[model samples]
Target: MPEEVKAHITGVVFQVLAKPGDTVGAGDAILVLESMKMEIPVEAPRAGTVSAIKAKEGETVQEGDTVALLE
Candidate 1:
């Protein structure tokens, strides 16, 4: 099964820390988001291989928007 990582706040994608096929463990930081002058980390919810990235650096994303997927 694949897991989608969603944004918790409306923000700009500050950085992408993982690429497709990258291995990630639960709680691993996958990306960073900047919102309201605060930096928030988007972490992996489960251990899996990164399957897709939907948000890119400088891209704007809203709360609940899927930023990446893992399988």
Candidate 2:
């Protein structure tokens, strides 16, 4: 099954650390979000290959929004 990597806080996408076909471990940072002067990572929920990233660099994302898909 596929899993979602969601933003924990509303913020602008600071960076994208992984791309489609990238293999990642559990808790690996998939992307970073800049909120309130802090950089937060949106991480993979489990070990998987990155399927897609919906949020791009500098894009604003809301809390609980799906930023990436993992399979």
Candidate 3:
């Protein structure tokens, strides 16, 4: 089954820390999001291998948007 890493708040993607085919653990920072002048690290919801990146650096994302796919 596939899982998703989602944004917790509306923000612009500041950077992508993981790529497709990368392994990640729960609480690992997968990307950074900039909102209200603050940079927030988006972490994995659970341990999984990254299957795809759905958001890019500098892209705007809303709360609950999928930033990446994990499995």
The models' CA-based lDDT, in order, is 0.94, 0.94, 0.94
Q: What is the lDDT ranking, best to worst? A: 2, 3, 1
What ranges in model 3 sit over 4 Å off?
Answer: none
Query: Once superposed on the true structure, which residue ranges of model 2 sit more than 4 Å away at CA?
Result: none
Clashing pairs in 3: none
Q: Considering TM-score, which of the candidate structures 1 and 2 is the better prediction for this target?
A: 2
> Mind giving the per-residue lDDT tens digits that candidate 2 earns over 21-51?
9999999999999999999998888999999
- What's the TM-score of each model vs. the native? 0.94, 0.96, 0.95
Angstrom error of the Cα, residue 27, model 2: value is 1.0
In model 2, what are the clashing residue pairs, if there are any?
none
Total backbone clashes of candidate 2, pairs 3 or more residues apart or in separate chains: 0
Instruction: Tell me how far candidate 3 lies from the true structure as C-alpha RMSD in angstroms.
Output: 0.7
Per-residue CA lDDT of model 1 for 1-71, tens digit only, reads 68889998899999999999999999998999999898899999989999999999999999999999999
